[model samples]
Target: MTREQFIKRIAPIAVQLRAEGSPIFPSVRIAQSILETGGTINPWNNLVGYKVGGGAITPYWQGKSVRKLTWEVYDGTRQDRVPADFRAYDSIEDGYRDQDLLFEKDRYRRVREAENPEEQADMLYMSGYATDPNYAVKLKMLMASYGLGRYDEEAVQLRKEWQERLQQLEQRKQALQARLQTLRQALAMTEIPEWAKEAVERAVQSRLIDTPLNGSYDFYRLLTILKRRGVI
Candidate 1:
């Protein structure tokens, strides 16, 4: 697949991982996956090339695994192609989730605290997440080439927009609740007309006014109640 196609396929998974509060930046994760799998689908579906070793599989992984010839740099000098056991997944999402679990381990504690994608990549390299000496650099290069950082930026902007919308909704809710309170107080006055009293009673009976009302109510909710009771 072309780079665009590969990115398009993983973009949703990256967004999903971000939304689920994965500490790893989606862009970095995508770039790493692209590098590990060579931007192609592998039979193992091991996006991160997660290894199965040190009894990591016995108690937890009941699924299948595949032994593949992988490149490993030893003593910071030599590269060797050796067979290693990599955990296989049923789907891409499951592989991503296992990556998250791996980050939660003590070995990746520093990586989890990395402030940004570059830092996270650096931490992964320092933490021995990969044997490639240039792992971090390669991941960063891939990220830049594919414009993957935009995904992280887009996620941030979307979250900010959602927060602003929620704030506006909350303000409107408070305003509606205050209006309802004022209307209730007005109805409580001794000189309230019988028609107003009847309308208030109807609103209460319709459950528009909660008993001992103390919480905010949405404006549209109040409008719907008023319309339904013919009080609008």
Candidate 2:
């Protein structure tokens, strides 16, 4: 697939991972996937070229794997392309998840804590995620060239919407509290109105009103007429 098509396919997954609180940044995730397969979507769904690494098989992996010739660098020495066992998955999403799970180790702490795509790419290299000396630079180049950071910006917007929703809920709660206070204060000021005062007083004397002051604001009009007509 073309580079843009590959990015389009993985962008949603990357953004969802970020929104779901994965420590990996979305831009870095997309760039890593693009770089791993050289901007082409692989059939095995091995987006990051992640190795089997002896990790216990789980839902994200299910013991599937593939072999590919890959490059490596050791102490500034570039090795020729060598055959390696790369993890495969049922879907690109699973591959992405497994890649994140690999970062759960203490050694990948810096990668997890990286604040941006650039830092994340560098930390991935510093954490020995890849043996390529220019791994970080290559990932950064892909991110910038493809505008992969837009996915991270989209995630930021999602968080902003949630924050705004929470603010609206807090405002509603404060309004409810104010309304309750008004009701409590209303009970104290519920004396009989001037128009109904005399009529209600007589009604109270006749025990027609069990609690004369407890009548609702609208009920006072009806109560006044009933008292005047001797209905009490």
lDDT of 2 by residue, 145-221 (tens): 98888899998888778889999999999999999998765555477778888777777788877777766556677
Clashes of 2: 0
Show how many residue pairs clash in every candidate, following the order shown.
0, 0
Error of 2 at 152 (Å): 1.1
Reference-based lDDT, each prediction: 0.78, 0.85
Tell me the tens digit of each residue's lDDT in model 1 across 1-232: 9878888998887876776588889889999999998888776678888888663643234558998888888887755678898898877877888778778889999899998999999999999998888999999999888889999987676667777999999999999999988887554543434334454556667786654233223433454567576774
Measured on C-alpha atoms, candidate 2 has an lDDT of 0.85
> Best-fitting candidate, measured by TM-score?
2
Clash pairs for candidate 2: none
TM-score to true structure, per model: 0.68, 0.70
